[model samples]
Target: MQNDNMKCGLIEKTESQFVDSIEKEAYVWCEKNWKHDDYEHQHNRAQLTFVEEGYQYFHIDRKIYLVPQHHVIWIPSEKAHKITSEAQTVNLMVFLFKSVFEDEFYQNVQVFAVPPVLKEMLLYASKWNQSLDENEEQDLFFKAILKSLPNFCKESSSLEIPVPTDTRLIPVCNDINVNFKYNLDIDSLAEKAQMSVRSLQRIFKNETGITLQKYLQLTRILKSIELIDTRQYTLSEVAYKVGYQSLSAFTSSYFAIMQVKPKINKN
Candidate 1:
């Protein structure tokens, strides 16, 4: 509801919802930290949301995705989802009209690497609001941006952290998401959910496509990535911050999952 134009663009309302004032093809909302009102909502247009400074978490269809900086989240039209962040974040969000791109490419929710060229174009395009009337020069730029999408948007699966859909397991899932640092044992989690350990194991794997142990480890690693990027804590400190008991154990786990060692650079 609070919209600051910032010489980037203006916010416009359509059907009681606040959306970026779009041009013929797309509209961009660049913000330091955008506070959204609705918990879950759908749009008639697809979106490409890129983080400019930090990371964001998105929940869609009972699954969660960890979207980091310089990555693009491609959300198709009519997909109901919600976004959140552990701290204040900055993002460059672009909404594209459904007609602007091919259906096959934009039909599903995906996270991709944002190529440099596309990043520049989006930042430049964010400066102007769309109009029904476009000059030849503006039209050329719009077309160029559209053509560049395929090159910049390469689907990535590594960052997706699955969340369970079952109502019974929802509480456990939420716990791991928010409290990844807690000592979460499978037996204790199952007991807390009022289900037997074996039953919980089966249900968790069936619904989330991951074993409980893997999910917890994945969640911790995702949190570690955020913490390491902050550069405020040493690698050892970050490991403990995210619930690992030993630095060696945390390093091994981090390398196994991330294919890289946890390194912090203050510079």
Candidate 2:
């Protein structure tokens, strides 16, 4: 078997070749089983990625956003970001466009639900790649998609957790993420971070703009969403897996963050 360094080198080389092949004014790339290391990079062109089958975690702008299945995420030009897909097989569709539009919609990172019409459009566009001729027809087709984005991508979801840059809080956040299934109280977190409870609370809020309790709650909800998407567990099982003893409480928190009910895939 190849060693870890060899595997990483091969993946990086493959990614570099892939990026070099798509230097176009507009491009569409689709893939299945798309797995890559957490490579942080930025593009000169704005990007929109649709997760069709599996989920992806987008680390951008000091926040980690969960782009679950059937959701789309927009990343503006020159924004530093990295993506991690834990799933073994992920179906993804990506669109890259020149940052020519002055619309406010393309100015910020957003993860939103994909409506049926938009979904169809994305699927149809998947046939075209960077090699497509740059003519008026092609321009119009891409422009139509751009214009329609602001309309269809209105309901943004807050499936994100702000990351703190402070050194003292990094381990705290990591612990919460890794041990999300446990009831991690402030006192324990403070102890782990080797700080007073009040200092931890104040500094965490100052750095991440969210209280420790709220941050923990958001972390649990994010994990629950991932578990629910897997279809391997019931809703109650998902709730408990994310540290909630009460299913109703889990449902409430999930809805509040996602703005939609937990979709239990009964397949």
Candidate 3:
């Protein structure tokens, strides 16, 4: 087992494991099974874990990423990490060597949402990986698969968690609006929507690829900005109204979620 800190020896599976094989020595196919277990592995090759079913929780440094169906997590070559999944989750991985994607991929590891065409193509490849024999079927599936590879090579921020579908989060969001300055904790917000904090956490992750904390911070800051846009309150007053006790706290949160800082003079 590889510790979270140590970069493990490389794990390789034959290209026959993937439905689509690149004619070049750019990638390899592998099946990863981490059901209901906790393990952390790091590598020098950028890896894509495609979730076939169930859910996966990945922690990079201390940030948690939820991987559900229709999504995949990209782990960069050097980051430290840990992943935990419950029973019955199946993940398909296509581990691409650095020599393959070349300089196109980003240095960071993150999740990308699979769109329609790519999803079908991957499903075809996965089924193909399992059904076919390992031989040089070079011209057929190889070329077709490789062309799609480069397009997907670039990182996309569009991949994200779906919004919380729970009947509660919306109302709870409303409650937050009505009582923006309450300084309420997540528990209180969850209770208003009749959900436990853990349940809230999972649903929120499923619906929005980001975490609850990030979303909450975004929400509070957005509210503060909207009110401030009217030019009615000073930055300090707006910050307090949005549940931020300290103006510095509000500014930091605002900048973290939205790349832009809040304007003290919106007029």
Candidate 4:
């Protein structure tokens, strides 16, 4: 699924050229196992990406979202962000649309479930790319998809983890992400941040709107998801790797946070 420009190592240049030259109201592009470089960029038209297989990580508004299979990532026009994935094989379908609808859903970054109908529409739209003519069949089809988005995209995914902004809490958050396998108690984190336990709890709650203990749980769950996606480790191995002493605890916590049972693909 590598395009000509991509095979020639000119993906960025080709995208810029298309954005500058294309005047159509809609565009669609499909790829397989595409690995975009690590950089932030934005577009004049709003963007929607459907993950048909594997998963993708989106960095938006200082938060990280891991969008798994059968999900969509929406980014509004002019919103700077970066998308990355560690999966070896990914099937992605991206759509770019002009700001025609006034729905608030189009104004923010969101990762949400993809309905069956939307998934079919995305697959059909994959036949066209770069630019679609106005009032044409492809254009009209995409317009209908955009009009129906708000209704279908109501329930957002809970796989997002917000990055702390406070200088004192940043390192603490970083340590939890890096050393999630270890037991990260309040005393250790408080000492690492050079603050009293009481002060750390107050500021952490104020900055991230979640207790430190809850944040640790979320970090471990999200990390577990990433590990599970790799399919190289069994569920028990993943649980231990993410700091859960028992598989039952890991499964319960994952279900509590994601509202879905974790699935392992060891093929």
Candidate 5:
């Protein structure tokens, strides 16, 4: 006594037919580079970068942000931005087409919290390296990403380090980066920039959005972070390498900049 509806093979439907089909309008991929910096540029598609190796510095809309390893930085479409790397690093970059999501999704620069599920999805998406193009499994994965976007993540504390673009300050910036181990004085920086100390202070603040003292401190702390991540140096050694006179001072500055004391690996 098989029912006519059951006998009509209604239960044999394939999975693809039930899932809503979507046009793939985006891409994801991973890339590695050895110390590179790019000039400011804008694009029609939004970019999300997940750092895998070293620190990334992003300058967007006159402010700079520090993108540390395991973090994702999102740059909205058509925004002029520049990226610089501290060392050799890997980045999982996803370019999302504006048509795939709401306009609000592509509005601001954001640093997102990457929970385990989202992290795994990002990695999985990176493997596609191309649009889904009617592929069922890939389409499902992409669809899952869109579904998980709303509840899977939250905003974290932004790591911003402002850098001035004034050409007069370029030499000063280079000196600090190249010889960060030395105690740099404002007098010397002003002399190097061929301006009075007061003038330098005024202009630096007006242009960079951070005091010179804090900027220098942040630069050293960031360098210390890079050294510590190598796992080859002790806390004291890293402190000395970055020109901190005492471990206590270095730890204070590190905590101030990073919001956590560095976890030393004594192995």
Candidate 6:
């Protein structure tokens, strides 16, 4: 049912319902309404979420990835996940099924960091969604994108925390964002939420699939990397800004999580 405002984000239309046949093992459609939703769920088919605009938080496992404009997050089949829309932004997703992905389904479900080539291909495919079976050229185009899906896989280890859809969690999440520098602890956070520490941990695990401490460490690490890459902060300053008291500890954590030494990616 369309809401009074008439906004929707999760589109669930089938081939017969939306478009004509595209090719064997593949179909195409659009999600006209991407709205604010709460909760985490996974599907039986590996799917592609192509965000044409706006921002959101994509939760898989227990790590949180901040999805900004033109970013797409792919959720593997049966991997529990939740998504929260960035305030007042359009959330777009292009879902691909397992058969279309072919043999690459053996790899882990990925939230690909979409590059230009992938973006262009998706845009082109979206345009032809209504033009399925137009010609042999259309068949080739579909095949090309199907092959490239594996190439879009990105290496992301940390997952986002899944907060329950509740008024209490919202303030708590906002507080975490605001006071990121302070020593983050479960007890303090629970105090803010007016809930017991155990309760907070329980829901956080249910939503994000990881411990709160682990999620916080990942969040700090991501923040540190962004600052370092900007060429504005020295590694030392970046360390302190992200709540790491010692550079060595920070470096160790960074290397352990990302499996790469900290250095500017100039290219």
Best by TM-score: 4
Q: Each prediction's Cα lDDT score? A: 0.71, 0.77, 0.57, 0.79, 0.68, 0.61
lDDT of 1 by residue, 1-267 (tens): 244522224343443233545455555456666665446756666777877767788888877787776678888877888877764455555545545566466677888767778778767766653343556765677667666666666656667887666788988887777878986777778976789999999988998788888888998998887887676888889989999899999999987775557777444
With candidate 1 superimposed using the best TM-score fit, by how many Å does residue 204's alpha carbon deviate from the native? 0.7
Candidate 3 lDDT over residue span 143-169, tens digit each: 454455545643444322234556677
Superposed on all Cα atoms, model 4 deviates from the true structure by an RMSD in Å of: 3.2
Stretches of candidate 4 off by over 4 Å are 1-18, 129-135
TM-score, predicted candidate 4 vs. hidden true structure: 0.88
In the range 1-267, model 5's lDDT, one tens digit per residue, is: 233222111121232111212245455545665344366655555667777666687888767777777677777767777778655444445545434466465477877556787788788777666444556776666656755564654654336766678989988888888878988788999999999999999998888777777778888987887887677788999999999999999999888766668765343
Q: Residue 59 in model 6: shift from native, Å? A: 4.2
List ranges where model 2 is wrong by over 4 Å: 1-24, 129-131, 155-157
Q: Count the backbone clashes (under 3 Å) in each candidate.
A: 1, 0, 6, 0, 0, 12
TM-score of each: 0.77, 0.85, 0.44, 0.88, 0.70, 0.52
User: What's the lDDT for residue 262 in model 5?
Assistant: 76
Identify the superior model by lDDT, candidate 1 or candidate 5.
1
Q: Model 1: C-alpha RMSD to truth?
A: 4.0
* Prediction RMSDs, each to the true structure: 4.0, 4.6, 15.7, 3.2, 12.0, 7.7
What is the lDDT for 169 in model 4? 91
* lDDT assessment of candidate 4: 0.79
Query: Between the candidate structures 2 and 5, which one is better when assessed by TM-score?
Result: 2
